[model samples]
Target: MAPDDIDATLGAAWHDDSPWDLLTRLCAFDDRLGGGPGERHAADLVADELDSLSLDPRIEPFGMQRWTRGHTAFSVHPSDERSREFEAVALPYSPAADLRAPLVDVGHGTPAEVEAAAVEGAIAVASTDSPAGERHTHRMEKLGHAVAAGARGFVFHNHVRGQLPPTGALQFGHEAPIPGVGVSHETGAWLREYAAEDEEASLRVDATTDDGESRNVVAKLGPESDAEVLVLAHYDSHDVGEGALDNGCGVAVALAATRLLTEFDLDSQVQVAAVGCEELGLLGSAALADSLDLDRVKAVVNVDGAGRFRNLRALTHTSEAMTAVAERVAEESGQPIATAEGPHPYSDHWPFLRRGIPALQLHSRTPGGGGEWDRGFTHTRADTRDKVDPRNLRTHAMLTALLVRDLSTTDPDRVDTDALRETLREAGAEPGMRAAEVWPPDWD
Candidate 1:
C-alpha cells in the first residue's frame, strides 16, 4: 500500500465505530477469572473474530492454579466493641482460614514496618499506598512481610478513597501463607484508629483452589517472515468488575488493529496474540513465550492497559532500541506517546522481555502524575465500559497498528541483553521479581 492509502486507512479507522462496539461487547461478559467460563467466552470471541478475518487463529490451552471465591468477611473483635462490618474481598490465591486475632496496623506493610509493629499472632493491616518517591510495593511483598512477621491474617487497605478494595494475587505459583482480605480506604482508616485503641480484629475467608485450564488466542496476518512482531493483549479479567478500563478496552484495540493491518501488505509477519489468565499472573503470555523461538521475535507491542487515557504511553522495558522505534513511530504517525525506561514484570510484555526480546507495554498516561485517575475503579465493580473513552480507544488502535508495522520491519540488532539486565537491577525490579517468584535462577 502507498503512504496515502495507509493514511486513509488509519483515518478511516479513527472514525470507525467498530472498536467501541467491540469494547462494549467484551465488557458485557461477567468475571473473566482464569479458567472460568467468562474467560473461555472471551477467548472464543477473539478466535471467532480472527477466524472471520481468515487469520486461522489457534487456541492453545494451558493449565493454571485457579482459586474459587467463597465467603469473605471482616469484623472488629471484642464481643461488645462498636465497629461496623466492613465489606471485604479475598485476595486471589489466599488460603482458607478463620482467625480472630489482634490487628496490627503496619502502615504500608513494608518489611521495616512489619518488623517494627507487633505483628506476632496479629492480623497485619497495611496501606496500599507506597511511600512518596518510593517504588510501588507489589501485593505479594506485603503478604510475605506479614507472614515473616508471624501475622496470623492480613488486610490490604486501598490508598484511594471510595469503597473500592483493590484486588490482586497475594502470591503466584503457590497459595498464600495466611488468609488475606482487601478493604476500602475508609475501612483502613477505621482499622488504624481502632488498632490504636483496641487489640484484635476478626478475619474469615473460605476459598478453594485447583489446577484448571485457560487458553491463548494466536492469529496471524500479512506475509510470513523469519522474524515476527507480536501484538500482545490479554483477554482475561478479575471477577470483581467488567474489567473494561483495565483490559477489555485493550482487547478491542488489538482487534481493531488487526482489522486495519489486514488491509495492507506487510513486510514481516504480525502475530496478534490475545492471551488469557493475566490477572492470575502473566501465565498466558509466559506459556506463549515458552512455545516460541525467542530469536524469531523482533519486538513486542503489548496493549495491556490501552484506551484508558488520551495520550498513549509505552514502557520500553529499558530497551533503548525499542524506545527509539516507539519515538520514531510516534513522530511518523503524529501521535503523542510518552516513553518510560523500566522493567515492569507485572504486565504481559515481561515474559518476552525477560528472555532478551525487545518489548513495549502500552498504557494510558495519567495527567499530573497520579492520584486516583479512573476514579480508583480498577479491579473494582466500577471499572465498566463507561470509564473508557471511545475516541481515545480509536486513536490508540490506529497508533498501535502503526507501531506494529514499524517494529516488524526493524531489525533486532540493537537489543542489548546485558544492558537490559542491568536496567532491571538498577530499576529495583529484582526484589519484586524474587518476591513474585519471577526471578530467573540463572540470573542469580
Candidate 2:
C-alpha cells in the first residue's frame, strides 16, 4: 500500500469524533487500585471495545501486592498551646504508624544531614530541593537517606508550584522500609519553622495492604509468528488523578494504532499490551516481561503519555541501529526525536530493559525541564482528560503505525546481535543477559 493511502486511512480512523468519545469514556472509568470501581470497570470496557473491533482480546490475570489509603489524618500543634491544625493529606501507600515523637527539621534529607540529626523514630520534615543538582535524583536520594536513618515517617514540603509528593512502592523495585507522605509547601514551611523554634510537631499515618489480582489486557494482531513487536501502555492511574496524560492518552494511542493495524494483513505480528499496576513499581510490565519468549521478540515500542503535546520524546535502551530506525521513522512522520540515556525507571519499559530486550519509551516533553506532565500530576487528583490534545494523540498513533509496520516486515534474523551486545555492554547491561531467559511455565 502507498504511504499516502496508509496516512489517509489512519487520519480517517483517528481524526473522527469517535476516537475522542472513546478516549473520554475510557478516561471516565476509575481504574485506581484497592477495590476501586475504576480498575475492573476500565478493563471490562476496554475488553468489550477490543472485541467490538473483531479482535481477540483476553484478560491475563495476575496477582499484585496492593496498597490502599486507610484512615489517615495529620495535624500540627504549635508551641503557644493552640489547638492542633491538620496540615496535609496523607500520601497513598503510607504505612501505618502512630508516634508523637518530636519533629526534626532536616533540610533536603541529604546523607550528611540525616547522619548528623537525631532522627530515630521521629517525623523528619525536609525540603524537596537540591542545592545544585538534578532535583529528581536529589529528592530520591534524600528519601532513601531518610528511610535509612531510622526515621519513622517523612513530611516532604513541596518546593515547586503544583508539585505533588511521590507515592507507591517507596523504592522502584523494592518495598520502602518506612511510610512517607508529602505536604503542601505552606504546611512543610510551618513545620520547619515550628521545629526551628523548639515547638513540638506530631503526625500519625494509617494505611493497609491487600492482596488482590490485577490484569494485563493483551490484544494480538496477526497469527502466531516467531518474531513479534510489542507495544505497551499502562491502563491504571493514580488514585487521585484520572491519568489522562500520564497514561489515558497513551492507552488511546495504543488502541488507535491497534485498530489501524487490524485493517491490514501483515507478514509479522503486533501485540498490544495495556498493562496494569505500572503505577506500583511497574508490576504489570515486570510480569509480562517474565512471561514472554524474548528470543523471538523483535523489538519493544512503548507508548506512554503520548499524543498530548507537539513534541515527541523517545527514550530508548536499544542499539544505535534501532535508534536510527526510530529516528528515521520520526523524521518521516515530521516529529522530533529526543533521545535519552538507557532505561528510565518511571515507565513499563524498565522491566523489558532489565531483561536485556531493546525497548523504547515514547512521550511528550514537559515545559521548563519539569521531566514529564505525569510527574507534575502524579499521585494527585487533578489529572483529567481535559489536559489531553487530540492532535498529539493522532500523531503518536500515526508514528506508531509506521514503526510497527516497518519492524514487523523486516527480518528478525537480519538484526546484528554482536553490535547489540556491544551497545548493551556500553549501557552497563552485563554480557549474556541479552540472551532471552527461558519462558516461565504456566504464565498465569
Tens digits of per-residue lDDT for model 2 on 339-378? 7645434578766664556776777776567553235554
- Candidate 2 global CA lDDT score: 0.67
**For each candidate, what TM-score against the reference?**
0.96, 0.84
Residues 1-444 of candidate 1: C-alpha lDDT, one tens digit per residue: 899999889879868898888777778887888888989998998899899899999999998988899999888865465756889999988899988888889998776788899888999999888777767667777887788779899899988888888888787655788899899998898899888876577788999889899999998888978988989899888888998987888998889989999987689999899998888888899999999887888888899777888888888877888888889988988788888876767889878887788888888855556732233578777788888889998898988888887877778554566777677788676665675677777676
Residue 162 C-alpha lDDT in model 1 = 84
Off by over 4 Å in 1: 78-80, 371-375
Cα lDDT of all candidates, in order?
0.83, 0.67
Which 10-residue span in candidate 2 carries the lowest summed lDDT? 435-444
Instruction: Flag regions of model 2 displaced more than 4 Å.
Output: 81-84, 105-113, 116-118, 126-135, 138-142, 163-167, 171-175, 264-267, 372-374, 410-444
- Residue 32's lDDT in candidate 2: 57
